[model samples]
Target: MLANPALQAFSMFLVGTALTLGDVHSHVWARACWCLTDVLFLMAFVQWLRWPGSYGRKLESIWYLRWGGRVSLRKAAEIVYSEARAQESVWAHAAERMSLDKSPDGILCYIAEVIKQDTTIYGKRPPSTHVEKLDPLQLKYGTVTNGAREVRMRDNAKTVFTDLQVDAKELRRALHEVRESLRTTMPI
Candidate 1:
């Protein structure tokens, strides 16, 4: 972000020189200016770090990447498990044991849809329409971006996302167990 290395170096040099000069008039103003410069640099640095294109964005991407793979793994596991479960209850649907009431692929597809929606909302893909625009108010601000908002909204959003993550993992784990049990006859 700081493309002007010369300026940054000069400022650092000035600050250092000011620190060592130890003069009343010149040093005072120089140190004051240096302090001001440092504050400005710090703020800019903070902003850059928080920018959507910076490490902040990268971190978010990484999280989603990990979560996405986990979600996929969960989907894979679900497929395997569901097959095994289906085999056990081939005569009668095991709707009771698998009380989830939703197919693994169905949930994965739904989650995938949500991910697509999130990406579109967050501008991951090209915006399709104005109504599809993301509301900044929806972001999990405290964990990701610091914003002024009532506790309820943040808490609610965090809870929803957390639930989604947990459900995805649990479903995936079940599928993984199923896959492990029937490894030899795995469909795909």
Candidate 2:
């Protein structure tokens, strides 16, 4: 029901040509062009009905690029995923997940995976982070040492705080700090 003006005009031209030629004498080419135009108009209307306005517009733009041979299927898929990830709903879900107590470890693991993938893809590391420098200490020991800690501690028993309670608030704060640091220093 939605009509693109140019398509409508072309369809009208085809119809007029057929009418002038008479129904019985109409050329097959005129009938074919009209039918094709009608089908295209219907398809466009159906697509407009199917998607929300903004999404439909974005899809239409991408569709043009795809059929125009300006982008490959793989690149189109990557563009779609990037656009989807930037959506507010997606970001909200990510924020909620990252705010959880277990998320910091998962996030760090994901970052490590991304680093690995980037290295494999580009044959080099993507960028540097504080985690890169502290990773060895964190892996060898359970924690990283601030220089102040060495001055206050005499023994391994004194260095480790077994009684420390990490509540959800503290975990969330720690995750935020880590996220901020990574955002500042890394492309992630």
Candidate 3:
């Protein structure tokens, strides 16, 4: 599209003429519509050129981060494990020994597993842990959706921290283990 100088000049001329004439009720409306149609068509074409499942995969990663931020690594893991246990998955066995207030690391480990499984199937980065460094995925997806209230993780720190067992050492180790395991097990 950018390589077509005549098309670019024509679009610019149409736009400038339309603006100077300010004739919304005249042929300018048709020009405007055509311009919009062209832009949309180009955008659709570009979107179609993208890899299959990439958009949905990106959306899932983003949702995971936003939701993950609402809870600590510990609590997020527990929520995942709790859901898994309720479904009676074998992964739930990992969480059987720990109480909600006692196993932040276990939760982190479980969260890692949950994310690994997801990314394996979906083909995008997974939810990150508290100890994990921020990735391009997080940076891309962490922005608040339009008109949506921004959730501040720090403002909810008390609840998040409380939900977590808050053992720094254990949480650290859990994060490291999960990161390592995911690196090895997650499909590219």
Candidate 4:
């Protein structure tokens, strides 16, 4: 119907927004309608448009940076962790123990997960964590939506981190073993 100007005009007439050529009107003549889809398409075809870069593209591109490599991921995670820890709140401490994943996917997931927790008691259930695969094409060209507003993952294996338990006795044993090994191998 949109392809047929007559049909479109008739529809517009039914909607009372049609203004045809050679049509004479009274003192007041004003009509408006939404008929620009084709015009928009034509304009889109006529222009050389640049698509947007994804939020993760830059991070991913520098993933294999010859100088720092994966150190970048770890460092970014450490900064995120430190900032949260510096909040000095119970939630901050708990987030500290989250054992955040130290990779590109991990950092994104961590940020998205962290900001999802609202500081309100509105009785609204927090949105559950969701595992969503990122499309390679979309990740290459399209922008990521709300990466820090909700907890989203590419897959179960893409989880930002896991809740871990600390065992005091096990920690002490590991430290003692490390100390003994270092003393015996002393280059110091």
Model 3 ranges with Cα > 4 A deviation = 1-69, 94-104, 116-133, 136-188
Candidate 1 lDDT at 135 equals: 47
Candidate 3 total steric clashes? 0
Cα-based lDDT for every prediction: 0.39, 0.36, 0.40, 0.33
Q: Where does candidate 2 stray beyond 4 Å?
A: 1-24, 27-36, 48-188
Superposed by TM-score, candidate 3 places the C-alpha of residue 83 at a distance from the truth, in angstroms, of 1.4
**Per-residue lDDT for 88-122 in model 4, tens only?**
33333444355265544444445334322211101
Q: Residue 187, candidate 4: how far off, in angstroms?
A: 51
What's model 2's TM-score?
0.23
Specify the poorest-scoring 10-residue window by lDDT in model 1. Answer: 143-152
- What is the alpha-carbon RMSD of candidate 1 to the true structure? 19.7
Task: List the pairs of residues colliding in candidate 3.
Answer: none
Candidate 1 residue-wise lDDT at 1? 35
Clashing residue pairs in candidate 2 are: none
Ranking by lDDT: 3, 1, 2, 4
Candidates 2 and 4 compared by TM-score, better number: 2
TM-score of each: 0.22, 0.23, 0.23, 0.20
Off-target runs (Cα >4 Å) in candidate 1 are: 1-13, 16-19, 22-25, 53-188
